[model samples]
Target: MTGQKPVTIVAIGTLDTKLVEYLYLRSQILEADPSINVILIDAGRAAIQHEAITVSQPEVLKASSASDGSLESLPRGEVVATMIDGAKRVIGDLVNEGKVHGVIALGGSGGTSIAAATMRELPLTLPKLIVSTVASGDTSSYVAESDITMMYSVVDIAGLNDVLRAVITNAAVAIAGMARGYAVRCATPTGSEVRKKCVAVTMFGVTTPAVTVARQRLEEMGFEVYVFHATGAGGRSMERLLREGRLDGVLDLTTTELADELVGGVMSANEERLTIAAKTGVPQIVSVGALDMVNFGPKDTVPEKFRDRKFFEHNPSVTLMRTTSNECRELGKRIASRLRANCVDASAIEVWLPLKGISAIAVQGQAFYDNEADGALFDAIKAGLDGSGIAVKEVDADINDPKWAESIARRLVELVNSKSKG
Candidate 1:
């Protein structure tokens, strides 16, 4: 271990409720590896016995100036939000400054929320672990796009029981091993040096043909193409990369996530789906690929009102619902409006429409074919851009047509090249 670097792990929690548990976790981490150093940060909202605190409450509170006076004086929601901001700043600074090697946290829902917020601020490859009572259930909100490992805490974190001791000890050992073995840092700093230009593309099962061709063309043009799966989480990942300056341009071919968001569906993305591309001014080519249907879980999960509407069983676990003309109109207006507002710094923005069809299932004889809905979408987008400077183009071929995909690929390459020259 002579050449090995020192390993430091950050233990985060609301120390007021779980002080004894955290202390045990810290001890176990040191016991696991003699070389591991531990820092106990107090993220508790309520006033606690400060004698046992490592990173004092006042220091943590200073990270976020947005918070009001006393932590207890504000409402519960405000407290959680403020602490999240503060924790993110503290943890992010530690990683950037190269003071912390890994992060581990133990909490229930509220505590997990605080720790998760901070962990997300770190990069994708960092070793971040969370032992939570809510880990066994839906953890989408907790571990959005980060590489945080969630270990189910069979017993509550209120106190130390025989069951909790083993769980906490195992989590401590896991983080210790990870910290000792692997060191994570930002491999490619944005704009640090010249490298391959990255293009972000969106794809779905039905629109795979378009994205496949586009990806090949972009790669052949000496660019790196990253295809995102158009699921709610996938869109969020793309947005994060855009914010981080990891992408050079965007080929937004599949806007199906918007339909899911507008309707109540399992794959729905948040309202901020397209805002990042707009605000970042990344040269983006938009399309209505796969916008013909909204995604839902099983057939039984489809809502009561939508039961009468057209439904296609994509698979045993997935159901697809066709969008009505009225719904398509709303989606078109929303996409155009967002682009109009956020594309100020963009060098160019174009909306491509596939007149023949938007997806495999939306063709002439396909189950999801609905010309009225598709037309409404197309017209609404054009109407929304009436005064806006963004250009709209229509192609005679279907969305999956080889020619259609090639055109989109060429358009993105042209925009990227033009931006570089300018």
Candidate 2:
């Protein structure tokens, strides 16, 4: 501990409204480990003058090209937005410069929004924790694809009481410990480490067998496989990693999130789901695994318009609606268009269509089986990539067939090798 670098923890909040609370939080952090360095960032609208405030409100406004006058003249939403932008820039610079090991913030909705926005920009390796009044409900918007930890504040962050103190003290201690570990990890050398070539694979409950066999085969071929669940957040996370150049290849076996996006389902990953790998020139083998179903919350939650659609109750809380032939065709066109439009080199991409079935429930007598829909999807993809250099192959077996999964894995290995050679 004597020779180790000091762990620096950043405490961010609106000082104008919550100066006392921030002071207490900082005190608790330093009390836990006096050697830990704490930097308090004031994101308040008003410029608060205090030596303890490492980054002032004025500095934040300047980072976002705003002034103190803008706070009064601008709408509350715009003011918060400007402050968030400023705080993000300030925090981003600190993280880049290795001045921040961990970040923690306490706030209501407004404070949480500012802090969450700033913290989300930082690296996932850095510890980010937020104690917020709205943490008990759905926090997908706040934590989206980031590893930011959210803690529920039992009471509002108005003023510190016994409950608030206990919560703040616990949060402080947790962050301090995390910061110490993070600092140690940062100091550790990693340049000499030998890591296997990593591949990102997408999966769904309906396509688990295919992904499982493929993942195993990939591992056997000496590639490290990261399997993402194909949920909205999971797909987004995988795409982010791909853009960051963390993945060497992709085996996109479960493109279900695309179905969710196309059908206005709850788990949509947006329109950018399949474009990152193409833009990055990462060799990818795409398939229509689980494209047969659009995810919904429950049987009752299925929209009134889709009441007549084929439905599979995955569980009491999870429902799957079969994609119509028209929807399948559109999804195919979207996937092919994204790949073709974004790919720097079409040779790096391959589309594999399973002829017999795409998902577990789509084979033979299962609930979602529909040859017409699957055919529409395949035809659209082929048509969309008609002149493109990308290769489109059809496998006679169902997606989960062991040999088919193995072939996909082996082809990805070839693609990766071919890219390296090129």
Candidate 3:
């Protein structure tokens, strides 16, 4: 039941058992927004004894299967993996074919898993709603870095009832309202202006001075700069954006995440952090922005093994630990090796070293002063890059100095333009 077919409201669930529930939802959504188009997607293999749109599961499977028809031929465990992959492909094809605008799915644990998997594959702008028993517990896993709204079914969806129907209707109508009233037009319009190149910068409070200086310098050079705090989430999101091809170049100054990664700290980035620059092969300028600190929770919560380490009270709740010489050596080698992986892009990268201190406190007269430790870090950077031809410079100024920041930005602009032209 549709009027203008402005949006395709997707009703997805286990059509074998929850067909009635999903069909009711489709009817309710259409009733709420007459202009909306309701498209039923049955991901389940078995059919239910009810009204439904019967696109064969085999057709959906074909859309996601590999060459030689091997994707559908996997074992049950592998099938579950492939089904999630298959659902994502089916939903994506539906979206591309202009058949679905908003998606609504209801399921128990297994169904919830598939629904969430599909919803996640859909972009952030698309409205997604899931009604599941899984929503009652920790939803972090189900909604990992996604925007799908989930509602817990108070009763199991054994069959549609007065209560269950009411819940489904609410979700359907809410989705309809979200879809019809405030339709999310994709940000990337058909004729919108082209995206400008954006610069990615990494910083912590310790490296704010440098980042601020660098941002201003890069902005003057006609580049958009996005600074990410050197925290776990910050690093992850930046890498995610880089992989999405959203970043033009990187000014990764505060490389403290690598220290935490190797030393076992709270703010440690995953192994993928340092390797991103090499993987993307994009023009990037990197330095030991905040290699001095290993982050932890509140001061009192620091682990027992590193109780004697130099601690800095960055703020009331946050604590920072200076990396040891050995830790610094390992971290430097790890970073150099990662950067060295992209030999083709090596000329596009430069590992600048600040001679004074890596961070504010590590300088000659600061509380965390340790010239030997700083030297160890510098030595690691030198030894790690056994000549991939990646430029490694040793600047005499402190990292926070304005000169240090400007130089990094200038070098990045040079590499970006070089790569852009070639």
Q: Top TM-score: which candidate number?
A: 2
**Candidate 2 wrong stretches, greater than 4 Å:** 66-69
lDDT of 2 by residue, 348-389 (tens): 999999999999999989999999999999999999999999
Compare candidates 2 and 3 on TM-score and give the better one: 2
TM per candidate: 0.88, 0.97, 0.77
Residue range with the least summed lDDT across 10 consecutive positions in model 3? 181-190
Candidate 3 — which residues are off by over 4 angstroms?
1-5, 9-32, 43-82, 96-112, 120-194, 298-304, 313-318, 360-369
Q: Taking the tens digit of each residue's C-alpha lDDT, what string does model 3 give over 14-68?
A: 6766777877888888888777777677666443344456454454556566423
How high a TM-score does candidate 2 get? 0.97
Q: Look at candidate 2 and tell me the lDDT of residue 145.
A: 86
Model 2: pairs clashing at backbone N, Cα or C within 3 Å: none
Tell me the lDDT of candidate 1. Answer: 0.87
